[model samples]
Target: MNSKKMVLIGLVLTAFFSSLAVFELIPGLLMAFLLLSVGIAVTYYFALSRMRLESLAGISILLKAAKEIGKESKAPEISRQLGLWAQRLVKSEAVLVWWQGEWAFGDEEFTAWPGLETAREWVKNNNEVLVLNQNGGEIFSHPWPSNINSLLGLPLMVAGEAAGILFLLNESKRGYFVPQDSEALEVICQQAAAALNKARDYQEVEYFYKEILFSMLNALDSRFPGFTGHSQRVARVAVLLGSKLGLDEEELRILEYAALLHDAGKVFFLQEGLPGEAGELEEMDKELSVLPMEEHPPLGAQILPDEGVFARICQGILYHHERYDGSGYPEGLSRTDIPLAARIIAVADLYDALTRLAPEEERLEPEFAIKEMKKTMGMLLDPLVVIVLEEVERELDEIT
Candidate 1:
């Protein structure tokens, strides 16, 4: 029976004996028997209740940890946080977690106990919880440390496979951890495994998306002779400038996509009269560049998805060629009316065109290129964006 029921029974017996004793209807020996039984039962019940409360408190902490773990997006970070939570839940002398071939928490300092390798192998092979007591120091693989007498190892199961193990250690208090501790730890490990799996899946998806983006950029570059590296160079320089200006990751991403695909509308302009080969266009075809120059920005915007994250990129492309002095084509947005991303791309696009696309003899040196760009800062480019570009150029010069 549970402690509550046992305590109730003891209380009833005591009341019955006290009533009998008061009326002189019970013997002294019988009264003594009832008194001892009541004392033992009440004491046991209180102790049991305290232990149960402690377990509940531990479980509560674990639940809070699980909620926090779910919000993380990386496997190593999830595992690290899980280890910390596990340590708090158990109040163990040490807590160590191993996941994805790396120690997530409680490294060499906490793992000085013997039989760790044995415990790790057991959990890995059985995919179950393993608890060990230093009974006469017989259960340890090495000479048992005098301070530590018990260890608990729990499997972190993910998708029917063991993802890792959580090891908890206790100081020389024999039988320090009970079966309930193991069960509570199992609950925590299950949540950690789920969080780790989710982080891994998210990372894989991000990697796949990046691969596709790079491939598309390469295919677009192949369409223009002598422009195979132009988009990538622009992307690199634009990102540097964006970083210098303190643009956050999301803003930098938009700027990057806009710069890489700024000239995408050129692909549509490859009609019968345009020289379509990979080399620089012949003098006769130079006039054809003007045909797309007027419409490429809008056409490039139309080439991307119309809504969602790419919308910002589309806006950047559509206004990339617009000038600060209202002399640009299509919409002629002037000054701050132009999007910042487009302005940054405009500077990057001009720099690459001057250095990489100009005829060999006509190409200017890096120092001269900065002077040429300085002439149109307020007229053709955003002055602030030009300043950032100038900083990037200076850094590049120092590096070279």
Candidate 2:
């Protein structure tokens, strides 16, 4: 109830009980005692109600923050964003995030605090939220920072398993971290724990997916020592060029898949007949059959599942060898008629093919690579793709 209504009800109860004692209708002692007792009870109830309202307000903030972190599906990004949310969670100036019992990111100075290790251990082992203050009895043997009067540590636990902890140091406008502050942090921690677990699962699946692709590509390249690593580099550079060209998330996903699987049609000729167990595939280093090199594009397209998501990916893989000027490939697709993903892979594939022939230290310099790349910009590769390649090369140069 609102304070005004509560007060009105309290007045009514007091007046009713006071009249009973004043008139001495039965026994004055019991009547007076009842009035006093009722007054105390009403005041206590009012205090509890106010606290409940404040707690509700805090819940609102917690939900908003949790929703923001929920949208991310990558563990590192989730942790980075968690640090930002931590400061707001408890109105702290600095926050340190720990994962797997080690510092992952956030304020480095929190690592300097003497009692932090002890505090963190307590939190992790107990899987609970801890609020510490210099003025309170929980004060540690080591001195605390003068400006900082309080500390809060919360473990990120899911299913009773703790993966990380959040430590907020030296609270600001919110005063000391209170029960409400720690409670807010706890809610966000749980949400983050779930997100972290999901992100990790996604990463594991992605790692295996890429590993399988590399295995197939390895089998295809087993015959040509100079051409080893060609397909992987093409996939890497294609994604980089695609990103530079402003392809959105889905486009990049398809582009990357197509690039990785572009040479997949040649996998069958690797003596094993098909890409087998990763271990078995690695051991069989037999030479590839002398198949028509130009046939692999159409063969790759046919091999990939053309249903749902892989449909566009297959098309891209199928026509990666097609040229911009209609002078190349199995279908002679020209210019934009070639799928964008294929066009991107085409540029990346040729660039890597030209440079990956030598050992790393002796490989063609990017400048020389680009000079060779420009020779077939129109006749052999997508013209626009080569332009983006130039920018990709420039970026690499500046980075190196």
TM-score of each: 0.48, 0.47
Please, what are the lDDT tens digits per residue for candidate 2 over residues 1-400? 6777877887898888778767877587787787788778788888898899998887787788898777676677788878888777656867887876578778667687777887887888888788887764653666777667778888888668678888888754446877667766776788888877766655543664567767777766665555566666777888888998888655776787788888887765555454343222222111111123677788778865566556777888888877788766788888888888988987887666445544455457887877866876777776778888887786654332
lDDT of each: 0.73, 0.72
lDDT of candidate 1 at residue 277, scale 0 to 100: 65
- Candidate whose TM-score is highest: 1
lDDT of model 2 at residue 71?
A: 68
lDDT of 1 at 74: 72
Model 2, runs deviating above 4 Å? 1-60, 135-139, 171-175, 202-212, 221-271, 274-400
